[model samples]
Target: MQWTKLLCNYRELQLVGTLNGGQSFRWTYNKDTDEWIGVFSKTAWKLRQKDDYLEYQVLGSLLPEFSGNNTQIKNGNAKTCEESIFKSLLEKYFRLDVNLGSYYKEWSAKDELFKSACQQFYGIRMLNQEPVENLFSFICSQNNHISRISSMVEKLCTHYGEEICHHEGITYYAFPEVEKLSEAKVADCICLMSLNHLKALPVDTHVYQIAAQNYLPHLRGKKNVTEKMYAEIGDHFRLLYGDLAGWAHTVLFCADLKKFQSTDHKKEADEGVKAKKKRRQ
Candidate 1:
């Protein structure tokens, strides 16, 4: 069993509308223990630890079976062989590498408020997400809150993914293929929390919300926004920041911290109204 913490960095996972939209899963490497952990299935999965090496069970049987037993694996201690399938997948499915500093500089230079938001919130960029998976995952995100989004993603992985085991207690599931979802009874898998809602939902909530708020005036449509519009917004960010689409969404959500402020304001407003009524009496 090779023991190296294989970091799975996918930006699509962090897209604004992704069911798995968060960046904590992208973490610093542990060189000493060679173990890494990521949040999937609404829980964290730590990589298996072994002497002389660390191994991340590539979630599905995306790779061929290794030839050795535990004894041979231990004695050999050779670096785990590269899985070309995974390499091709890493390339084909995700947009991995990015220059975050450049993107930040450019975006901040364009807007002072954006610069202040980054300084206040310590914004980070997104990387390595597959577009098709992003589309489906975001479809699962419509009108739903984060907790439910996480559960929905877990269900999709557990139900459709090919599973693989690592340590005695741990296992991982890969994201299912597009054809699997496209052919699926979309309603059976997703619910309104109904799956019918899923068919009509777009992939990026930031795009949807922003367009709804008319933040981007160039886009115009009837009553409901279109998936193409949301994708176009994501594409615009991708063009401006390369792979910072996920990062941009995070920053936007963070800037909207005023939603909390609005809640506080409502409480104060109610209290003031009550005080005025008491004095009037």
Candidate 2:
């Protein structure tokens, strides 16, 4: 595929921050080429941002399974492995449409700590990851670190997921879907530790410490933070930060880790208010 380039402010979205920003587990940085590498849509790809533009290049052909959603190219005279496909996938996956710089500016006005954190990671934005994959990754994150979570997620895919491609002797497997995961034995899935669920932030040491000390005092320095407390603190954050609470959580919660903890309480509350007005009417 021809090299594809898209212009983006490096100060708004970056490869290093997003890939390692406590979300995705499959991406790797190739320092020699200054590129971030990962497999998506059953294809291996390399992405790098230079100056003010983000560049994309796919290493190998996508497997047949990635065809159904991409029939537009499949039927066209152009190559099945077009740069446009990668561009579209990358844009959607990274959520390039949302302006992180604007968000950071909005958050900086709200809190001093958030201001500092945002400056440190000015370009960092919460990746809008697929819910199911995000859930399983966070599940593996319990009592584990990023490197370990990544390994566990990889193992889950390799053991249960369908093989997508083989290049440079490395076999890449798509992250398994619900049906694929369900087909596995309970014992095996447990052993893999890849079972999935999430509502609040992907809580880690930083978020835990912050919650214990500043956010939720119920724990009050207690070593144990319950799942209930996690949700409560997350809800409290939503109340404080409103619509962008998830993105705000991402900025304040982590130095080594980043997560967006928020809920749709605002939307729900608005709906309730509208319902009460309708009754009065």
Candidate 3:
């Protein structure tokens, strides 16, 4: 496998936050190599980042190549065709066309809390995931945490999704298609998050707590989120953050997660150490 350079900045795309910050659960971080391994669009990918760009390695067998009209192309340049298709898929998956910095500035200007969150959490962008995979994975997300959700998603893929490849003694599977997930459950807000409906806010316990304390104070003492309250919470965020409310909601959600707290603290500490070293010099 050859590593292809993907034009991206860490500020525009933080692999850790984007992949593990609760949007999709398939990606696993290899701490030793500082690489992310995951499957998307029926292909397994290995990704790592540098200062101003990303490096990707396509793993396993390449899927059948098809043109815009879904016709298989038989040509001598099949390898080139696969690379072209994969590159385009990567761009679309990350929604690389959207100017995240501009949106961050715009969102920060509108909301004070979100502005603070932007300072701590940058480069957390919404992924444009496949609808069938997104729908089924998020269905597993309901009433679950990231670890368990990931396990469930893995099981689904292992049982139903096509086998992609084996690497480092572990096997990767493509996310099962819609037909394979006929009996699977469903969830709404996260499905919207994956589908890039920026205004759709999926309210869960954490979001409800945040809303009760900051946005909707009336529900402070409530035990659970009722159906009516769910819509109201979604409406509140949409009204506050405009069309990309869901994107803004993600920043806030990530900020509130305990999982990211230690990572942020360690990063800040590392930066502090680097600054001190500069001062000593």
Candidate 4:
């Protein structure tokens, strides 16, 4: 099994504490194993080469293009094609082409801090991603630290998953199927679950806070903010961009400079109120 490198060259995955700290993923290409091994804190995953290309999964373990269980295109010799597929898939998943320039312009005007930070941190470009994994990952992110979250996600996969056998030494698990999640018991998950624990960097919380503050003001005062609320927010983005749910979460998660912008907005609003009071006096 030949392991192709995954994610390191990508800037979005490089930024620590971004996307709930993808840095914790610890992806490396192992020539010895001839597989790409993705080591999370608790569980590990592998991508192995098949007939011509390489592939992997998180919940079920590693699979190759030739593996009958997985229905994916294999890219081996075609490195450019492989990378392009990743980029294009990410873009299409997030609806990134939707008036993005104007969105950037608007953000630039409203959040100079974010603009400057974006320029400094990511070289002033947008990075998009897929949704299902993003949403579930963010869900795993709730109230959890990066290392712990990574561990839990891996454990979940290993506990209830199939191994994708490629070569002699390398194997992996695909991301957990939704059916597994839907069927999961809190007791079973409690070992790995960190729901509502409310970590500062959890993308789900970040988006939830943003939408609650801006989109659904009524929920702010309500007592029963059900799991449905969280699902709705995730679903909202999922429907808006079929594949880019993960990218949107990444955007929101990595928009740390946006925090500064938000602070500035509050400060300006307070100053405006003070100015009005002084004028009235």
Please report, in order, the local distance difference test score of every candidate based on alpha carbons. Answer: 0.44, 0.62, 0.79, 0.42
The TM-score obtained by model 4 is: 0.42
RMSD vs true structure, all candidates: 13.3, 12.8, 4.6, 13.9
Judge candidate 3 at residue 147 and give its lDDT.
95
- Cα lDDT tens digits, model 4, 28-114, are 555465445553312244454332233443222132423443323222233455445443443332233454444444444554443
Instruction: Give lDDT tens digits, candidate 2, residues 1-281.
Output: 45568787667775665676666788987766767877665566768875567887666534563455434332233354555666777777667787877767776786677776665455665565555565576667677877889899999989877765565678877777776653323221222122221123444456767767765676676666577766677677667666657566765644434332224423533454476457558
lDDT of 1 by residue, 1-111 (tens): 333343433211222212123422222234455445443322223453232222343332433333343233223343335344334443332233444456667778765
lDDT of 3 by residue, 1-281 (tens): 56778889767887777888899999998877879999897877889987678888777643654434222221222266677887888899988898899989988898888898776688888888888878877778878999999999999999988887777788888887777667554556545656567788888888999999988999898998999999999999899888888888988998888887897665853574476457558
lDDT of 4 at 9: 23
lDDT of 2: 0.62
Give the Å error, residue 183, model 2. 9.2
Least well predicted 10-residue stretch by lDDT in candidate 3: 69-78
TM-scores of the candidates in the order shown? 0.49, 0.73, 0.87, 0.42
Global local distance difference test of model 3:
0.79
Number of the candidate with higher TM-score, 1 or 3: 3
The clash number for model 1 is 15
Off by over 4 Å in 1: 1-36, 39-61, 65-96, 120-123, 166-168, 183-250, 254-281
By TM-score: ranked, best first:
3, 2, 1, 4
- Candidate with the larger lDDT of 1 and 4: 1
